[model samples]
Target: MILKKGQLSDAILILLILLFLFTPLGFYAKVQLMRLFSFAPSIEKQETSQKLTDYNWQLVDVEGNQSNFSINRGEVIIINHWATWCPPCIAEMPSLVALHEDYGEKVRFIFLANDDSEKVRSYLNKKDYAIPVFFENTQTPTALKASSLPTTYILDKKGNIVLKEIGAADWNAKAVKDLLDTLLVEH
Candidate 1:
């Protein structure tokens, strides 16, 4: 069979197009094939070396009390900066409540609601969330910046930021609880 130059070019172009379309599948297959390459640290190793004392955050307690964390002092403080209107913050309320119930005394769970005290009080009155929520007066760009809603900061026993997740997160997730437990144990 004799093919013209244009016909050969067209066939080659179509084959190239199909290859481009299916090349992603090969990339995905390679990832699956190499899945064993994934490496993760063990729980014990992760906990003991959790660097919570990185960010200098002003301390706010469960009882609506405000204080300053002197470096290497207050260990294992979970500072959740949230607002009343944030959906992710509201969705994670139950977990926060559970965290308070389970490890409130064991660790310091500080719920800093970034809103007016009246609004926070009103919101609290509706539901029975026992976590003491406080109001932070620090400016937007201060030591503890609550610029975004649902910004959570985890501080170690020595008053260092071990982790900071800026968004709504499953507070009751095993990973989160494990990390918190590790932080508490360090204290």
Candidate 2:
């Protein structure tokens, strides 16, 4: 059929829109939009063979008690870097809390907030989260910076970074539990 020029343009425009909406480009666009709005991205698991550096980092508990991170080196550690203003950070907290409930005694969970004690405490109190919260009292090491909010690191007993997730993750996932189980068995 012979179509008018205006009608042809409309058809082409619709075709291009459909192509963009149905392709991987659309998914990428959506992810970027979500990040802009502070929505957490899907879990992406990573691992590294690098050993953790001994940074003189100090963490204070809710009761004003202080402790050095070095003391926990020989134990399995899960260190999470987060901020109250970060949406992704807020998004994955529930999973972390649940994980804590299941493995609190067997693992060392350290939540380092980018904000001050009062803000972190307020946020935690509002959410009624039982996970231990702390603020880093010293300079954070460059190696520990995973370049993203809600960055999490799972360190083996020997203080090696075995798993590093750069975004929000399902801490209650079977894979995570299995890994923790294996680590628990290893000393």
Candidate 3:
């Protein structure tokens, strides 16, 4: 049977539309279309390294005592970069404390505040938490290059980064616990 011109054109158009919406190529096409319409791509997180040596983070204790990362080199370290003003960071404080209670001795948990040490002390003064606190004026760690607040860096015993998470997360979650367990085993 012979098809009319309009029918054949409609069939081809349907095929193209389906192909344009169902694959990786389709996603690219959508991106290109949005670009042509003057839309910008969503911002992506900056990539960070997974090696502890990549970042020379200064160490500290709850009393704001300065130290070296080497002191905790032989143990797994959970480096939490936080600020008092950050709501999510504040919200995750209890979870972090709970995490410390469960694995504090096994792993070296450090809460590195990007604010003044006094500010951190004042904040913790009201809480019954037991996590060690430290202060870092310059927040440039190779393993944690995140420009966002509430970033948690999980480092192995040798200080190598095992995982980097941005935004607030339940530290007691199984995924996080499993990852920390693996790092502890490596230690």
Candidate 4:
């Protein structure tokens, strides 16, 4: 059927609106899609010979207790910088939880939420995530600051950044576990 000019423009506008609503708008959606197709952690192996920055970054637990990552020395460290409102962050939490279950005793998993304690606590409570959750109690070190949501840093016992992944990833994958196992052995 033939359509009037004004009607055609209105139809195009509606189509565009729908597209925007359904498509990935921000970095979060793009990361989420990337995680869905690849269930393994996107690991960029760093040279173990290189030294990592000191773990003096301060963080506060949900109870307001102060601590620094230095306390977890001599163990593999997994620090995840995430936020509640980030879709990619939420998407990869399950894998993190599972990864914790498998390696919680051997590895130190620290989830650093860029959000407030109340929001993070509420989110964790609702989701029943048992991993340690902390909020930044002081200015985050430039090295620790994430360029994007869902960034993760895996450190060996010597505090060297072994893997620095910038997007959501499947933390429970065998490769991830294998890497953790290797790190555990080296320590």
Candidate 5:
């Protein structure tokens, strides 16, 4: 077959795109893209947000200590549902860790695992993350149930879900910090 210069360049470009889309490198690439483009989640108006009726989710830590969501019921909480294999979750983890490091004393952070306990432990250990992680011991609360991987809920002191993000977001953004600080003081 005869090929012209433009056709050859187009074929090479297509081949490169195909390789990038199919190889393991694609995973890393997607994670980088997600991190690069993620934004802070929008705040929900108090009048329009969902309030939790119960805070009694049964959960177990990686070390198998049983816990209940009621422990954090009256505090500002950040509950993130994530899996080790989810690219968006991985992408948002660094920022989330940073946020937790700064607010751990003032707010409770829950890194909910949707994957196997051993795998979640290994992944967090490999990444040197000290965030608290939990696995469902019995059942998750309806308010805390995530409809998708990488979902996150920011709850105010009264159990009002102030922010519910369904995908990757920059949890370390200034607006998020401001919101947390504001939520910390409200009655």
Candidate 6:
């Protein structure tokens, strides 16, 4: 059958849409879309922010070493809950890695994995990521229990949760760096 000029363009467009909606390209497309749209997470106001006053929680390191949350008391902390299979989590990882690379010494970063997925280890190794990854073996602290994957909370030294983001974000953005700098000077 002979194709009309406009019909051919319409047909190509439909095929391209189907390919993006069905194949592995779909995941890559979603990641790119998320990366393009993600902005720095917003900080909470002092009066409206939740504080991590209770440091009663446990986390097991990748080496199976157990540690109490109290150890990070009086420190600026960035806690991110993510999973390997989570698309948004994957999307935000590169930015998170860049942030950690620059501020790893100044900030205490805990990348909390919701489950002990072997894929998590492999993914990190493949990427050569140096971000600290930990597992919650016990009950999560109420203020830090992530309702969704890719949830991240930035806590000031005083335990006030300054930022709580629940989706993909540009963790390496200038706004985030500025916030971290501000938190560093905070008591």
Best by lDDT: 5
Residue 167, candidate 2: Cα error in Å is 1.0
TM-score of 1: 0.61
- Assess candidate 3 and give its lDDT: 0.68
By the TM-score metric, which is better: model 1 or model 2?
A: 2
- Lowest lDDT 10-mer window, candidate 6? 40-49
Q: TM-score of every model?
A: 0.61, 0.72, 0.66, 0.80, 0.89, 0.86
Clashes of each: 11, 0, 2, 0, 0, 0
Q: Write the per-residue lDDT of candidate 4 for residues 74-180, one digit (tens) a residue.
A: 77889899998777788888899999998898889889988877888898899888889888777766666788998998888887778888777888998998888
Give the candidate order by descending lDDT: 5, 6, 4, 2, 3, 1
In candidate 4, position 174 carries an lDDT of 86
Range of the 10 consecutive residues with the lowest summed lDDT in candidate 4: 43-52
Task: Encode model 2's per-residue lDDT on 84-151: one tens digit a residue.
Answer: 76666766777788889999999999998887778888988898888877776677666677577879
Model 1 agreement with the true structure over 6-114: per-residue lDDT tens digits: 9999999988777644775544443343333322112233343344333444545445566654432565777788876655566566667877788887777768777
TM-score for candidate 5: 0.89
By the TM-score metric, which is better: model 3 or model 6?
6
Give residue 98's error in model 5 in angstroms.
Answer: 0.3
Q: Any idea what lDDT model 4 has? A: 0.81
lDDT of each: 0.62, 0.78, 0.68, 0.81, 0.90, 0.88
Candidate 6 lDDT (Cα, whole model)? 0.88
Q: In candidate 1, where is summed lDDT lowest over 10 consecutive residues?
A: 34-43
Q: Which ten residues in a row have the lowest lDDT in candidate 3?
A: 37-46
